[model samples]
Target: MINEPSAPTATHEFDLTTAPIESFTALQEARQEVFSSERAHDAFQRTIRGLQPTGPEGLRRGLGAWMIGDYEGACDALSAYASDDVASFTHANALMTLKRYVEAQPIFKRLAEKYPGEPKAQGGYAEACFEAALSEHGEHEIDAICEVYERELAAAGEGFADSAEGQYLAGRAAEVRRDWQLALDHFGKARELNPAMRRNLFHLGLRAERCGLDLEALVAYQQLASLAPVDLPAMMNLGMLLEDLGRDQEAAACYDVIARSRPMDRRARLYLSDAVAGMDMYYDEDQERKEDRLNQILRIPITDFELSVRARNCLNKMNIMTLGDLVKQTETELLSFKNFGETSLNEIKEILGSKSLRLGMGRQEAVLSIESTQQRYVSGENAEAMNRPILDLELSIRARRTVEYLGCLTFGDVIQHSEEELLGMPNFGVTSLTELKEKLTIFGLELKPRQ
Candidate 1:
């Protein structure tokens, strides 16, 4: 028979000063130490083992567990000391770590209200509310929570603003507001303040990508991959960028590692196959020359050509900036716009004729190609099924968040995304991709074929 560990002593009046340090101070120090340590998990376990495992000491143990990445253990230990202010704050943090943002939001709110000057309380509340909003909460609720979070942060003052956690919270708030540049700035500051914040680096990559800073995004992802080689999301994103840059062999190597690590993952397998096939694909010089010509033609501005003032004014009013933009609009669309008459349309047609192109001519072949590909992949009842709303699928919270982020509301929208596109999203990991694939399999659907 095995003996169990002894139960906690019933004493509530134990002196925290008698320990290695005051309980709250010890908790804070332990959190910082673990965050900055190279061997964070080992350091966290060792710190918690040295602490007494009852009463106020439970608070230290709980915080250490949270710092070490043991979210469930943090919840269990912290729950016993929920009556204490510091413990309650850590408990809410643990809940957030477990992705129970809805459950943690009110707890964070209570702490923020009770301690209006505490940056941790205010920042935690803000982060929880922002996460809840991302998970599909109403805009009105999110706005109210943001208002409170801002007030509390303001009250916490400059000292809080300079802290790493504060910068991270500011980054998250900026992200919720769709301010990608501001989010990236805050995340960069946070990383500078705390180099161990790998998650912030990941967020930096995501925000940079969204803001069209491709080089910055690539560097961020590369740094993160170097720090954590087994980080599938970072590796996958790096591979996608490499492939887009025409580095097929490097992209294939990234996929090969993921495939080896996750043998059962169909998405990884598919990506590896595509990358390998790409390596063997012949370069089409004629196609390249054609694309180069098309790009040069498209870059020619409408203003570069001679036109009557009235015709130029009409095109300007319609926001027709380039030859490509003008060619994409049909005669009907141009005529329907205000003050554009048949004479102006004739003038535009003449300009296009000079270039051997017609209105709305560029999209026809592209649409046909897409239609043909769609026909090849789906048929009969499956085609109808593809129109169903993505919300109908029982996806996990992480998967749902990713689909929403991509603005994919229907099965068709989801199917249009390749594995690389899905994995390129921040916070979308192997598990989420696998879950999505399983759901699609139910409808006999898969990701769009690689180009």
Candidate 2:
């Protein structure tokens, strides 16, 4: 017969200070020690079996299970704990790691609110908020989550930096979410406080590159290359960044170091070819000037076209910065933006139209023809090639031209000519015929067939 572990035997009042620190404390601490020692999984499991399984013991057993990669076992043991703080936090974390975000979120939030001083709980809360924000569509809910995390971290007291692990976690989360500046700041702080954390240098370099701080990124990547161990991600990343910055010889040396360890890596070989090509295409001064000009243009603030101050404020909040930016977007793209509506669009269009502009790309033919013709007229110029006699008129130029060619110069002359006679003219097809009839019809002059 299989034997099952007995139920919670000791129901004594839980004391934070004096509760018999379960035998599993030693076991939990041992698992951590074993993990730090970098022992094999089976050896760690043997150490776990030596601990007594009793009250508040479940927490250690669960943590041991977590350390040994048994997520389910960890969660089960953690759920049966006398103290909810650590076990609840660990259980929620296990759920999160298993991608059960919905299940983990509430538990994390509860723990965060209950143990506000605990950095692990705060980190878990931030993770839950981020996951929730990601599920939100259209609006950038991620920004709200980031602000929440930043605010909470600022509020956290002495234990905030107890582990550089929280800093690394927050930094990585910011990086994956494309918040480059935030990622760099967190990684930079983490590296400064814990210089032994070689990975932070690599992350700092990556985020620096993305945020357009190239010189800083190059220095960071160089440091990472020097400090990182064999098979380090930083080594490859450093070489790529150096190659991108047009230092081919230095990049080749870095790649050579990586190739020594990973000889058969096709990806590294391809990267070497790309690095060499990048050196050929690098243009320092010209590109820098272009970027400076672009940034200068981007800095110009757009005037509020919306008549009401309220509407303009709403648009500003939605990040609509320029008239040129507004014009490039379609009606659908405009409507899709948060706080933008038909009323705002109509008001903006009315304001722009008063200045002879539009909310969208203007009608090309109308604008171009008026522009070209008005200039010519202002210069006392005639665009006509020849003053031909009333024969061989181009039907495409003007309908009036076609009508005049058939001995129909005035409205009276048009009334006198039959539709069939006008149709007989060269290049005067049904399109022109229909257009003439429609024009005449508006003036109450009907075109009849000669028959």
List the global CA lDDT of all models: 0.67, 0.55
Q: Model 1, residue 261: displacement in angstroms?
A: 6.9
Model 1 scores worst on lDDT over the 10 consecutive residues at 368-377
For model 1, the superposed segments whose C-alpha errors exceed 4 Å read 1-78, 81-91, 106-118, 134-149, 223-235, 247-265, 272-451
Residue-level lDDT for 80 in candidate 2: 73
- Steric clash pairs (candidate 1): none
Worst 10 residues of 2 by lDDT: 374-383
- lDDT per residue, candidate 2, 128-206, as tens digits? 6666566553245656666766676666667675456468657866786787777787887777776545456767887
Clashes of 1: 0
Could you tell me the TM-score of candidate 1?
A: 0.43
Q: Please estimate how well model 2 matches the true structure, expressed as its whole-model Cα lDDT.
A: 0.55
TM-score of each: 0.43, 0.35
